[model samples]
Target: MQLLAQVLVNGVLLGGLYALMALGLALVWGVLNIVNLAHGALIMLGAYVGYYLFTLLDVDPFIALPIAMVVLFCVGYLLQAGILNLIARAAMFNTLLITFGIDVVLTQLAQMLFSADYRTINPGYAGANFMLFGITLPWVRVLAFAVALLLTLAMWLFLLHTRLGRGIRATAQNLGAARLYGVSPKRIYALTFGIGAALAGGAGDLYGVVSQINPYIGATLTAKSFAIAIIGGLESPLGVVVGGIFLGIVESLTALYIGPTFVDVASFGILVLVLIFRPNGLLGSTT
Candidate 1:
């Protein structure tokens, strides 16, 4: 029972992290209607950025997050404005092809620059942990979890209370009406995509602290994010959190009982179930 409790705790922490990871993908898909196949590549780039900052410049991983985010934001913005804008109104299938191409290009570029070596960001307290109600908690995981929730709340607030946030929601719902209100669909698209990239980068920064990073990890991360996004529903930020935590707990239990090999199988299986029964998602509307 104690072991089960520990696994549950671990799963919740992991779920928070996953929530942040999927948030970017959800944001872009929800607001910009861009599937962003290159999302994971951007995350890989962010992990690399954080890794370098921690090792080369002695910047704290937490502190380096913003830098990585800004860099990816620029990359996302340029991709959207300079390239994606050309096909913004094109078929969703076309967007997928373009994004897939971008993913391939970014993956190759990262491999060329960083090599395929698996690297970890080992901080001074990489192995530090504390006991809580008989469940051991790592400082890094706790901090990452907190940061994830904070960012999620900030994202929700941004969309609810800010001018640009309103503009983004407006554009998402009705591009034509948004333009009538002086919203530049092109600029909004670029900015929305940039924000999504920034979130992915932030997640990558936190991710590097917990796991091994390689150029190839993007594909798996992208798949995981996709599953989480769909399961949670793109209707609200809270849905991402719920989905992430749900998957996290499920994965944690699966790993404990069935072995880690079947974790992905379990996750994707649930995703398929959700799609069949709840096509709109756990929180998405039937309409």
Candidate 2:
């Protein structure tokens, strides 16, 4: 029973990070209607940025997060404004293809620059942990989880209260109305894309502190992000948290009992089942 409890705690902590990881993808998909295939590649880049900041410049991983986010935000904004917007009015399939091409380019570029070596952000206190109610929580993971939740809440508040947030929601509803509201479709698109990339970068920064990262981890991260997004529903930030925690527990249990290799199988399998039964997600509506 104690072992089970420990696993559950670990899973919940991991879930927070997963939720943040998928938040960007879900936001972009839900609002911009752009299934950014390069989302994971952007995440990989963010991890590298954090890694370098910690290793080369002696910046704390936490402090380096904002830097990674800003860099990715610029990249995402430029991509949407300069390239993605060209085909914004085009077919959905085209957007997917273009994003995939971008992913390939980014992946190749990262491999060229950083090589395929796995890197981790080993902070001074990375290995520190404390026991709580018979379960151990690592400081790094606890901090990451708190930050993830804070970011999600901030996103929700921004969407519900801010001017630009309303503009994003309006654009998602109707491009014509969005334009009528004095919101430039081009600028809004860029801003939305930038926000998404920023979230992805934040996730990557947390991820590097917890695990090994390489140039090729993008595909897997992308797949995980999709699963979490679908499970959480695209309409609400809280839904992402629910979905991420759910998957984290599921993956943790599966890794322990069903063999580690089956973790992916479990996540994907549950995703398929959820799609068939609850197409809108556990916490989301069909609309």
Candidate 3:
């Protein structure tokens, strides 16, 4: 029973980070209607940014997070404004192809610059842990989870209370209506994408502190993010948190009982079930 409780705790913590990882992808998809295949690549870049900041400049990963976000925001803004805007009127398939191409290019660039070596951001206290109610909790994971939840809440607040947030929601609902309200769709779209990338960068920063990262990890991360986004429902930020926690718990249980190898099978199996039964997501409604 103690073991089970510990596992559950671990799963919940893992879920927090998972939710952060998927938030950006969900945001971009929900707002821009652009299924950015390069979303994961952007995440990889952020991880590298955090990694280098920690290793080269001796900056804390937590402190380096905003720096990574700012850099990725610029990258995202440029990509959306300079390239994606030109193809805004293109078909969904074309957009997908273009984004996929961007993903490939980013992956190659990452491989060339960082190599295929697995790297992790190891702070002085990374290995420290504290016992709580018979369960051991690592400081790094705890901090990562806290940051993740904080960012998720911050994003939710941003979407609900801010002027730009309303503009983003309006644009998602109807581009024409948003335009009439003096909301420039082009600027909003770019800003939305930039915010998405910034969120990805933040997630990646935390991820590097807790996991091994390499260029090739992007594809797998992208798949997991998509699964979480769909399962949680893109209707609201809370949905992603729910989905991430659900997946994290499922994966943890599967690893403990069925074997570690079947974790993906269990996760993806649940995703398939959710897709069939609740196409709108567990927390989302069909519009």
Per-prediction TM-score to the true structure, in the order listed: 0.98, 0.98, 0.98
**Candidate 1, after superposition: displacement of residue 265 in Å?**
0.4
Off by over 4 Å in 3: none
Candidate 3 lDDT for residue 109 = 95
Higher-ranked by TM-score: 2 or 3: 2
lDDT of 3 by residue, 1-287 (tens): 99999889899999999999899999999888888889889889999999999999999999999999999999999999998988774788988999899999999999999999999999999999999998999999999999999999999999999999999999998988888879998899899999999988888888899999999888888888999999999999999999999998998999999999999999899999999999999998865
Q: Tell me, what's the RMSD of every candidate?
A: 0.8, 0.9, 1.1
**Which 10-residue window in model 2 sums to the lowest lDDT?**
177-186
- TM-score: model 1 vs. ground truth: 0.98
Query: What local lDDT score does residue 28 receive in model 1, on the 0 to 100 scale?
Result: 94
Candidate 2 per-residue lDDT over residues 132-239, each given as its tens digit: 987888999999999999999999899999999999999998999778768898888899999999999999988999999999989998999999999988879988
Please list the C-alpha lDDT of all candidates, in the order they appear.
Answer: 0.93, 0.93, 0.92
- Pairs with backbone N, CA or C atoms under 3 Å apart (clashes), candidate 3: none
* Candidate 1 lDDT tens digits, 67-125: 99999899999999999999997889999999999999999999999999999888999
Error of 2 at 205 (Å): 0.8
Q: Which runs of model 1 end up more than 4 angstroms from their true locations?
A: none
* Model 3 RMSD vs true structure: 1.1
**Model 3 per-residue lDDT at 2:** 94
The residue pairs that clash in candidate 2, if any, are none
Per-candidate count of clashing residue pairs (backbone under 3 Å): 0, 0, 0
